[model samples]
Target: MLTVSEKFTAFRIHKDDNNKISSGFEQLSLEQLTAGEVVIKVAYSDINYKDALAATGKGRILRTYPLVGGIDLSGVVIRSEDPRFQSGDKVLVCGAQLSELYDGGYSEFARVKADSVVNLPQGISLRDAMALGTAGYTAALAIQRMEDNGQVPERGPIVVTGATGGVGSFAINMLSNIGYEVIAFTGKTEQAPYLQALGASKLLNRHDIEIGTKPLENAQWGGAIDNVGGETLAWLTRTTHVWGNIASIGLAGGIKLESTVMPFILRGVSLLGINSVEMPLSVRAQGWKRLASDLKPSKLALIAPTTIKFADLPQAFDAYVEGRVTGRTVVEIDASLD
Candidate 1:
């Protein structure tokens, strides 16, 4: 146990009889935190859908209870015994069992295993990393796989479903920055200019790409970054161009996949599963480095979240789950006004 005798607070979820959900902020001793090689003064933690799920108990995102509920965090190392990190160094962590197998980052401080923490590379601030958060990391993983599989910007417009959401918005901006003519797909017609501002050359309504009764539809998209699963995935698989790829990042729409193998066999379309959590630390570092360099958004300053005090997180988190959040939402825990 690495006890530094520091006092802090965190929002924790604890279940009562009948498994009813209740969560609120609680004061914690340094020793109450889970054991880890490094202890950080948490600087930034953004609200993600998974975090909302864990907080609300709407989904089984957290396999454990009585847990702190943040899946990604960026901050400065305050105490460390690991050779790879030392006091005052900045870093960020995403996925890596936070709010799952261990206590997490919705606190004024955190203790994280050194094995899963990635030292933030040059060119990205700790704040920027948390603003990107798990959603952006998942987006980066999907785009990296697409490029690896020979999908190119010149092939055609890359379609990104769920364009108004975090992963979709980040991927759209990143793809457009790399010169891909991006097609943004969304249910909200009001977000057209917003998506276009992120470099989407076109907008497609969700209903336009609804799961058709047919199996194989016209091959339109050269490649895709799909965050919505179920029928949206099926449509993307069947309708993507020959030899193109679709990176499946979420089951937000659903888990059921009802597509045939014709897209895989005839057109040679490929589906790559991207699990940001449980990724090797080396690979996670590489993804973060790439995000810092190429995929980092040019307009992150404009497109990034509006900051809120730690006290406001519960209502904001509830708003997120109720489908009210548009862009990012960062909690200012132990943050300086500067």
Candidate 2:
């Protein structure tokens, strides 16, 4: 049995007085963790683009030093002051300022606000929740918002950019499962079979999407989930069907949006900005419930996901930074903790 006196290991990022940053596993007691209303014995944590940025110091993701480096974690609550949680309650934490303003789930344990944690919905296991992680949650939120904007499968095909990445992959799978004709835009044409198995009906190579010099183009897709911003997003803005919804989620390509208001003013295009980090608890719960039910992929194991141990995190993070990793990666922090 675990005890409070024992030390736990966590992958932490630290900066020296000279401002040089470094990261690795460190031993720490519970008292050293960020104060929270609840404590969790972490079982699984997943890698997202932001997590990689925080871990590698490649992006301005971490606001504090000596911080745990995971934005998504799943575990059993070991202690709680909140009336809603108790010992042995399965819960998952995604974003909510994790790995930024507070300690996160790169450790065998995590301390977080009770309000930031959500009980695992029925039909989704702890591991399964981590498998979906923040990427899947964000994709589901985008879909939900698009549906609210009158996007329907019967209208036309939905396009997903960066289709091989985490959010794009989940968006394609969920949109396809929901009966939409899903077209995937990817740079990896060789991964066509993988994208097809994920339910993408058509595959467009990166070169296929032109950054035309026009304010507007012919309408194609009825809706789009864009993870790759910049030119790709500008292209979608011009070509999306009238009244089409475009959920702008990531800036993997570039943050600068160079597009005219023609698409919005003329076609009634709706561009939604998805920020998962500060999502409200109620909205998070709804997304998880849908993930546990209608949006759950049948062959989630087929994402060709990679599972790594705690010690392998640094290397995994490097792979992600180099653009070598695709799909989801679950970090098994403690097999026994599960």
Q: In order, how many clashes per candidate? A: 0, 0
lDDT by candidate, in order shown: 0.85, 0.88
Clashing pairs in 2: none
> So what's the TM-score on candidate 2?
0.97
At residue 170, candidate 2 shows an lDDT of 90
Let me know the TM-score candidate 1 reaches against the reference structure: 0.95
Predicted candidate 1 versus true structure: per-residue lDDT over 15-80, tens digit per residue = 887888788899887678778888888888889888898898887777767888898888888888
* CA error at residue 188 for candidate 1, angstroms: 0.7
Name the candidate that leads on TM-score: 2
lDDT of 2 by residue, 118-217 (tens): 9999998888888889888998999999998899988799999999988889999999998999999988998899899999999998886566788899
Quick one: best lDDT, which candidate? 2
Candidate 2 lDDT: 0.88
